[model samples]
Target: MAARFSLTFDSVDAPVLGAFWKTALGYVDELPPAPSATRAEGLAQFDLPEDDLPEHGVWLCDPDGVGPHLSILNVPEPKTAKNRLHIDVRVPGHGSPDERWARIRAESDRLVRAGASIVDEVDGQHVVMADPEGNEFCVAATSA
Candidate 1:
């Protein structure tokens, strides 16, 4: 079996940026690690602010325990260039092209409402978007 892995993002605010990602990716907040927990365990425990915003902490996990965990960390520099690697939000679709597009559009709209803006759209392919921090990602419908 493949080894477990996750994605890490550098950010100015881990909470705000991580929240956008959690909503965009349908992930849940990862619990803060135990005081005596190992380093890795502590990484899982992200301390969210009371309002869950304007706070300090990092980490989100797939509730179903299938998808990868996400780690957001603070950095001194800002994003000055396009991302060499970005996420693709994959939505499995079946049946006609219309059905596929409908599914993809629905997810795209959901992300927009969650503070993501569309960057580009490809016919029967994918919708590119940027998070509130200008981190680009794509939403796509799977081809059978």
Candidate 2:
């Protein structure tokens, strides 16, 4: 049997992180409406405990709907330090380092406006930025 896996982040602001990932990965948020009275009444026949779910949570699937979902959880505490594991994004094509840097900078600016912090810039070749929750990710220049 294949193993099942999902990435979960203990986030102080789960909704924010969820939104970021959704934008970055082009994943859709899954939102189901409240159970209908008939459905709830039927479930109650089984004496199942009431499902008290959070009003705000995020669930995303890949474009193919194959495997692995990313779940961002809302916790009481924020991320305090650098992540031991981080994600690196490449620009998707080949070019001179300078050209790549310029592109990276432009993209970084967009992210910055979206609540990301520009932690550092390395000669436009790469940038280190933190999400709203302070999880760091790197955007690097690349050749097409």
Candidate 3:
């Protein structure tokens, strides 16, 4: 069996980053465990110190339950360098290369409206983009 794990990102503003990712990935906030209505309430159940509680973090999960959960944690420092690891938003479509590339551009444009900025475009292959906080990711279609 394969082990499962979640992705964690350090951010100056966890909630903002989380919101952007939620929209970009079609994800929703991970609900707190049963009996706790809110995440804050859930944290309260743990009896952790106010300072220790990750009040600045946000948790998100795939709505279809396939992808790993994403955790954005607030940190003191700002992002200083390009990410060693990143995400790729795959856009699948049918028809000719032009059609597929058009779909990719449409998706990239939507992301730009949602606070992502286009960094580079590699012809019909992919579009490199950065999130609001400067984390890099790509939007591309699979090669056949």
Candidate of highest TM-score: 3
State which candidate, 2 or 3, has the greater lDDT.
Answer: 3
Better structure of 1 and 2 per TM-score: 1
Write model 2 residue lDDT over 1-144, tens digit each, in one string: 988877777787677888887766567764333452443343345654344234334656676676467767666665777899776656666667667777788778877877788899876568998888888888886545
**Whose TM-score is higher: candidate 2's or candidate 3's?**
3
lDDT of 3 by residue, 28-73 (tens): 9999878989888877878665675556999999999999999998
lDDT of 1 by residue, 39-125 (tens): 445544667434433244577899999999998887768989899999999888587888888898999999899889999999767
Cα deviation of 52, candidate 3, in Å: 4.9
Q: Which pairs, if any, clash in model 2?
A: 93-143, 93-144, 94-143, 94-144, 95-143, 101-124
lDDT of 3: 0.90
TM-score: which is higher, 1 or 3?
Answer: 3
In candidate 2, which residue ranges exceed 4 Å CA deviation?
Answer: 1-5, 30-52, 64-68, 142-144
Candidates, ranked, lDDT? 3, 1, 2
Indicate the TM-score of model 1. 0.81
